[model samples]
Target: MSLLDEKQRGAILRALHDLRRAAPARPGEQYGAPGNGSSLLLSLVTVGLVFALWYVATNVGWIKPLFLPSPQAVWMQLMDVASDGFADASLLSHIGWSAFRVFGAFVLAACTAIPVGIMMGVNRVARGVLDPLVEFYRPLPPLAYLPLVVIWMGIGEGSKVLLIYLAMFAPLALSARAGVKSVAIEQIHAAYSMGASRGQVLRHVIMPAALPEILTGMRIAIGFGWTTLVAAEMVAATAGLGFMVLTASKFMATDVVIMGILVIGAMALLFDLGMRWLERRLVPWKGKA
Candidate 1:
């Protein structure tokens, strides 16, 4: 009564078995995985070592005060900014503005890029039309286009958001396109053989299979967007971490510059960690066959 012959069923079972065997031994653990506790400890130790070197260098005059302020001086500057504000705005306000711009651009880029990338992957015409354009812009740095954006959109929020959006768009689109292209042909064939419609196949098979790569792309895009934030905010911006940093550097306020750099690095690290957690939740079989 079964549609699949005995040989077909056996082959399917064997394939499933092999897939399981090829999977990682545990969730979040690949080959030669280290213990989580050990990893955390080692990371903390490395950070401490770097800080110690920084303190010693500043104190011993191995690095000039102008070039690298002491840790104590930087700490005092951070406290001052927290209490008195920087560049006519509080540090928190600057951070808030920066976050708003980055997230706005990132969300817009993700929404448009994912769908367009998926289309490009599935339709040859779409790929032919868009691929050359994406490839051309993808390699150009954000600063290269900043002047044009400012000229067209003005040095307002529109230009800032557009700059970051352009920075994020390419990576997300390319990643999604690559993900779809990487789908197993046999899986598509199997879905079709089961009488699934094109919509059903795309929804249940292609999208799910491609989600991990898409998410990875999103993480990369966010990094690119964040890196472009300084350039974005440098264009007639008054309230942003980038604005604060640029303002401090102009005044030779090394401490403020360092604090801004640290804040940006910390925020980027947190976002990256959050993305990794989301990827694990959404694609539990990411590393599994």
Candidate 2:
């Protein structure tokens, strides 16, 4: 307590307080600072009003039934989720299959992207060699590869996983590269001055410096991956929510179509939540994930 002046201590305390409070949301908002209950209530109220509008619009036929099913119709369909399976696959099965495909490809991307990105960061020669190729493929659309990927890999699980892997891999690699590059030159010098080896410097210094950027990239990649994953499933999948939605549309089972849409949305939300959890766990420096 006596080591610092009172004024300096006060400033430090304030800074710590602000840092601790800087979470994902504002006070009272969902995932916000600890004490902002008002914001949380407001968020809930807004969602409720949206639901109310939706219920009213459908029930009163303000919108045509074809265009917008009433809340009752949607609710009935949702209830049947437990009662009637989706396209011979239970709602649970659809979610499970979709999650499996997305996560499987995501794991592959992470494994391949991280090591190369780290190497790219530490080795100028590697960067020169890889950067051009990475940039070339990075801008291409993931679905653009569908035709060739199917041609090369066939329309089985291989094609589906390959599509998702392509969609997720480039962004992750770029992010890892950026993270590697963002490490301070002086930190590398300091490590060298301390007799640290190149590999050791990369592991202990460059990596930590680049971690924040990497996490940022991962969040973006995961979001892009989720969107592309649906398209992948739509192409040929028989069990995923996207397939169910496509099949339901063929017969105009609009209720089932809506249910599938909701299921996809729910799954996406769950993934986003999982990302938040990971961010919080891995990057405590980030405000609430």
Candidate 3:
């Protein structure tokens, strides 16, 4: 082999030997290769720069500490949280409640949305019924429904869940609809020509093609849920991070507020990363555009 080919061959040989000595993949398995270290380093560097800027900006009072807390104070709060017995409850406790609310709404919306969206996309009658309602509700803010939700469900977890659901539902429904509609016309026709049933067409052609867009919608919906949580938790939550931020506003504890905001941002980023990973795995052809 030439030099480049020899290098590739050597790498493959090494990989094979490593695999032979290593543990086998579990059922339903794929290779667990190392990820892009350069990209990981770049992300770490970006975060470091952002915190440096934040630290400098707040200390110089370029931005009011009321709005932007110092990095040191925020770090102290994080240390407090990590050390134990912080925030009247552990940080994880608050995070657990918040995650429960977000994911509950997200799951509820997705369960209803994916099916409704598929029906709307694949069936003209269903689409006719759904199109007008989605159009009417899509533009309305989930916060706009807060009053009605409270009146209907009380200012309890039920109402909060409803608000999150409303926040997440519309974008996802639209995405599912788009995905369904984007299924190639030729594929449907070909399936029918092959004497495939309507169900078979849906299963084999529409769902597979539409998964990427559906996932895209789900991601958007989750983001909206995150955005809506501040308002949602404004109701009667006593211990959520949202509540912590809201309460800290009175004491002007900008450090805690900033930390809470950063926590929310980190959570959102993590969820987005997870969705992107799922998208890539589920739709290997998604990045073609």
Candidate 4:
């Protein structure tokens, strides 16, 4: 009962596919596409230009070495720190310590904050109770409460972890709450019509919808955790990248300071990349309109 022969139908389908392939992605659609290679090349080119400029500026003495050490000097300092150690510990040890504090606090915050945020989104009472507290402290800088944290928890690893934890908690919680609230009412109603229980609805409907936001929150929370690391390590910290950088500054080791900064930046960037990969794996539909 076909209106046309197989060849005509096949030709129409092929044309439709070609049209789709040629179409540009709309805004808030695909996160990446086949053309990503060009974008990556541009990024690499930009980085190369920046480094070239830095090299020229330093070698030409356009900028003082004190303010900005040459990239060569920074690299030499990195090698020295890696092999001979810095601030009474190897570079790896400092990195390990800093990672321990940042990631431990990050994990703790994610575990606690996400659930609280979900509760806040789902229940007015929970929202009422926690909203004021989260809002009150979130705007305060870590330095503002560092002294209080030290006084209460003492200058131990516990205090450092807690400091970073507090920094991350608010953002994660808020993001999760926002994610839950963003879930469409129609989705909930559809789930309910299918005889889904409250628990099932949350598990299947709300959680998936909210996952993208929660993942985004985790990314933000980790950044906050890293930001708080230096403040945390300031409290009686013998070994950490933050401590090393602080110590080096006292001795006016600009190269060491720059090296530490680069190392930290690299680590943070790696974590962000990991988060992005996870987001793609868990919610490939994200960014779609």
Off by over 4 Å in 4: 1-34
Off by over 4 Å in 1: 1-31
Q: Of models 1 and 4, which has the larger TM-score?
A: 1
lDDT of 4: 0.88
Top candidate on TM-score is 1
TM-scores of all models?
Answer: 0.90, 0.79, 0.82, 0.89
Output the TM-score of candidate 1. 0.90
How should the candidates be ordered by TM-score, best one leading? 1, 4, 3, 2
Candidate 1 lDDT tens digits, 1-289: 2555444545544553455457766644655677779899999999999999999999988999788999999999989999999878998999999999999999999999999999999999999999999999999999999899999999889999999999999999999999999888887787667655687668767887799999999999999988999999989999999998899999999988999998898999999999999997888777763
Tell me the lDDT of model 4 at 205. Answer: 73
lDDT per residue, candidate 3, 90-181, as tens digits? 78887888899999999999999889888888789999999899889888887788899999999889999899998887888889989998
Candidate 2: 10-residue stretch with minimal lDDT: 1-10
Q: Per-residue lDDT for 63 in model 3?
A: 89
lDDT of each: 0.89, 0.74, 0.81, 0.88
| Top lDDT prediction, candidate number | 1
lDDT of 2 at 96: 82
- In candidate 4 the C-alpha lDDT for residue 148 amounts to 94
Candidate 4, poorest ten consecutive residues by summed lDDT: 11-20
What would the per-residue lDDT of candidate 2 be over residues 50-125, giving only the tens digit for each residue? 8899889988779876777777887788778757777778878877887888888888988998777877877799
